[model samples]
Target: MINYICNKWKAIKRAKNILKNKNKIPPYLKKNSFEEELNYKLWSTKGARFSASHRNHTLNKLSSKSIGYLSAYLIIIGIVNLYDINLLGIKILNNQVGFISTAFSVLILLFSQLESSENFSLKSERYHNCSLDIAELYTRARFIKNFTINPITKQSELLQISIDYDAILKKYENHLPIDYLQFQLTKPEYFGLNFIKIKWIWLKYYIKVYAIYHILIFGPLLTLFYIAYLK
Candidate 1:
């Protein structure tokens, strides 16, 4: 029983040592070091890409909702103006309809102004470009790590990788901040699924966006037209 306990204690110590070693940063990657900078650039680029995607999706949803509501409000005003429409045999006055529609329109206009101020789509594209640049550098580094066998050749390759990393960073200096949720959402597994599944999932996402936007914007207009024609 003593031997068994000793063996278990030793095993636990070994496991802890392995974990500690794995978590330790190499001397070459110490603060302000070339390798550390390279790693930071890679991670920063990845985070910016993910944050931009999150922002893009959020702005798109907001824009769609605003447009949809604005269209519905406008259609209501148009129908009221053009036809003698009433709600359950009670006529709504033109002044009241105008006031309500104008209020909603003003609210939507304010919301739209806020959305336009951010210009998330343009930022998303910029981040995407930066990510591509960093990805190319990262791929080169990986290739060197994988293929270079001789110690001298490996050192030469690492030097080249550092140079390339610095050049890419200088060329694309702008970076976007990333939140934790965005970082998690944009991980490799998020978009690295099989090609068919990716296509199908994206297709469904786009379809849903389209359907909701069009239905909200056009549904009321179509209904108003149908009602006008019947009268």
Candidate 2:
């Protein structure tokens, strides 16, 4: 058992921690074997699915917040117009606020439509459930490897797990390549990623997942502040 654990930590030197030490568990396979490939695929796919689920959750949150900001800005505009404040001259202020509020109303309407159409909350749930199913398959694979005695039976069980993995993929929308890359970053040891590579992975992931949301949520607020400053 000790040997198996040590070899497990050591033998996962291949890209994405390919299982080279079949002797520890299955005990009869060579390197670059089917078991190695299946192990990597199951682990990587599970990670990507979970990452995608989280990305969608963030998207939902940002969209909701954008709407809230627009609503608040509109209310502020309403309150400002109630008085005869003329920080930028009353006529100029009126024109600017009118244009800004009209634009904000359009944005709020568009964001509301997108909130329903994108249905990010539902997509997030689906991705999470898919990941959970994949995790179950991964556990079963590990169980078969560790405990099963008959090599032929073990191969059959692993193959079935692979098949189930395929079926699960077919049932759900495919995750983005960026999502898989995000997964790889999560397991730096598995992918043999260095410090710089890890940072690059995070950079790419944040750019892909959060960049647009930042623009959507923060851009308008910044613009509101800019307009206020101008006034």
Candidate 3:
């Protein structure tokens, strides 16, 4: 796995090097109006932000789902053993539970392996970093547009902005473009709530999905223990 990761990183570096050597501002940008250049920078920054946000969302969701499933499976096994109860009154022997747990373990293992192979988390982080870099360039361009009036100075600054933008693009040229659906999902409305509110919502969501599963799995064991203590 280490070797595979190393190779992938090396390949990405090689591609970036090649792109840097060949990078150039688009022809249209060579003589574009200030307004046109600003618009382009704004659009490019938005695209990068949208892509980064979508990838981050996907990575988070996948992680939550995988962990939830594995946690539920383990909790169920522990509860059944601790209580010595036939869950749902369905007779299940120790060996049968072992088999079931092993099957689930295998499934989780395969999922983890697949996720690692695809490197979705790594790619998402990289895209997010690229977006931040592009945003910085966009801010600089906006500042230049607002403050600079001399045509020659404006042109020189704009050219430099284009070069910087191209450099960032070349470094992340392999990043997949955000699809229409992803773009829609990443709209501000989806995360427009204040930070505290958003975190509360996420907390409730995880509790409903994962915490409930835990309670269901462990409730019987606790109940059994309580009854024995009462006796």
Candidate with the larger lDDT of 2 and 3: 2
Best-to-worst TM-score order: 2, 3, 1
lDDT for each of the candidates? 0.64, 0.81, 0.64
**What tens digits encode model 2's per-residue C-alpha lDDT throughout 1-231?**
999988887766553344544334432234658877787778878999999999889888887877777798788776777774553443436787788789879988987997789888999999999999999999998888799999999989998999999999999999899888888877777566799998998898889777876887677657646777787
- What TM-score would each prediction reach against the true structure? 0.52, 0.78, 0.54
Best by lDDT: 2
**Candidate 1: lDDT over CA atoms?**
0.64
Better of 1 and 2 by lDDT: 2
Per-residue alpha-carbon lDDT of model 1 for 34-151, expressed as tens digits? 5456655566565766555555666577576767677678776768667977744446688877886787678678767876886767766766676777777777766766787887
lDDT of 3 by residue, 69-90 (tens): 5768666876787678765455
* lDDT over C-alpha atoms for residue 177 of model 1: 34
- Candidate 1: list runs displaced more than 4 Å: 1-44, 47-51, 61-65, 81-92, 166-180, 186-231
> Number of the top candidate by TM-score?
2
- Write down the worst ten-residue block by lDDT for model 2: 20-29
Show model 3 residue runs off by greater than 4 Å. Answer: 1-38, 50-54, 78-83, 173-231
Q: Per model, how many backbone clashes are there?
A: 0, 0, 0
